[model samples]
Target: MKTRAITGFFFVVVMLGSFFAGAAVYSIFFGLLAIVCLQEFYGLLKKSGSSPNVATGLINGAYTYAAFAALFHWDVYPEAQTIHKLVFLLVPAMLAVFVQELYRNTDKPFQNIAYTFLGIIFTIVPFSFFHALGFVTNTGFSAHIPMGFLLMLWANDTGAYLVGRQFGRAKLFERHSPKKTWEGFIGGIIISAIAGYVLSIYFKELEWKQWVSMAIIISVIGTLGDLVESMFKRSINVKDSGGILPGHGGLLDRFDGLLLAAPMVFTYLYFIFN
Candidate 1:
């Protein structure tokens, strides 16, 4: 428990620092995080007796970097314009995997290659939305948005845990996640709403309605993200992705909620404000 607390503290500090540091810094940090997470993801697949090659790993890592770069570099190039380039680049990258698998003549090569590709797209692609959101400028207002999202998410998770421990009676989703309860889920939503109200005062750019809307989205979607990761772990019969962090499990586990929440938040911001 002590180790978990210490590690969680350090993780929170670094995460908070990076978040406040601006788009460029956050992009770099999240980019590296995506790479490490992809690596860990492939490792998990391998441990499950699925073979993902080094070449596949490198290509997937490159894909993740490219996605973030495209989103962050939106000022220099339009998103639609860069997306065309992404599709062009991905063709050969994916083909290389099939070509390698065919050359090696491995059993179930196509299945392995497909799964590797899916893992990269599913796990890392959504995070690019975060980079996109960071780059969307409302001057000083943009700076506060990511922090607001983080605080709301953290509050939801923390509130759920505390409430669930104290007064959880009815299970939320027993098969996917046994510990989660309906009471805790409602508590998380309440806490997130409060955090959103508090942040709206300082954000200035967003109205109270927008802030509340965002908070509700984050709480619900973030919980879905956590449940998704829980499902993944259950499918593989593992308790954690990796023991890289004492209590957090793996990079994937730590960021799973963010991964799921980011895209949804980004979409909301874009549609509502843009």
Candidate 2:
């Protein structure tokens, strides 16, 4: 318990530090974070008898993140031709996954290819969207949105845990995550909405409604994200994703909610908020 608390404290400090350290640190931190998470994902697949193309996936995952980082850094709009071309570059990288599989003599060639791509899609793409969150506005890389989003997410997680341990009875989704309860889910949403309201008072970049909407998305989608990761782990017959974070399991476990929530939050901020 002490170890978990200690690791969690340092983890939060480093994460918040990365955000306030400037745009470069934020981009680099998440860019590298995507790569590390991809590796852990591939490791899990490998344990489940799927030989994912780790090298190719890692290289391409790094490339994918860097591409998004570049796009976000430059504030490139979708209508720009460079944006189209930059996105076009991913086609070849994705195709390379199939080509790399041709050389592997494993019987599960298609399975390997699928897992490789899944690792990228699961781990890299959402992080790319998260990276864009900091630069979603043309305001030149403000941390308000990203930081607010995280605060609300943490609020939801903490609220759910506390409430669920006390009053949780009805299962939320017994198939994927048995410990979760609808009571906890509602508790999370309420706490997250409160957190959003508080954030609106300080981070005036977004109105209270928008912040609350983001909180709800993070709570609902983020919980789904956790379930998805739990499903992945259960499929592999493993308890935790990894032991990198000591008691926190792994980077993938820690950021599973962020994985799914980041993209959804980014979409809301990009299309609706912007």
Which candidate number maximizes lDDT? 2
Q: Could you tell me which residue pairs clash in candidate 1? A: none
Clashing pairs in 2: none
| TM-scores for all predictions | 0.89, 0.94
Model 1 residue 144 lDDT?
74
Clashes of 1: 0
lDDT of each: 0.78, 0.89
RMSD in Å for model 1: 2.9
Clashes of 2: 0
RMSD of 2: 2.4
| Model 1 alpha-carbon drift over 4 Å, by segment | 74-87, 137-141
Residue 273 in candidate 2, Cα distance off native in Å: 3.9
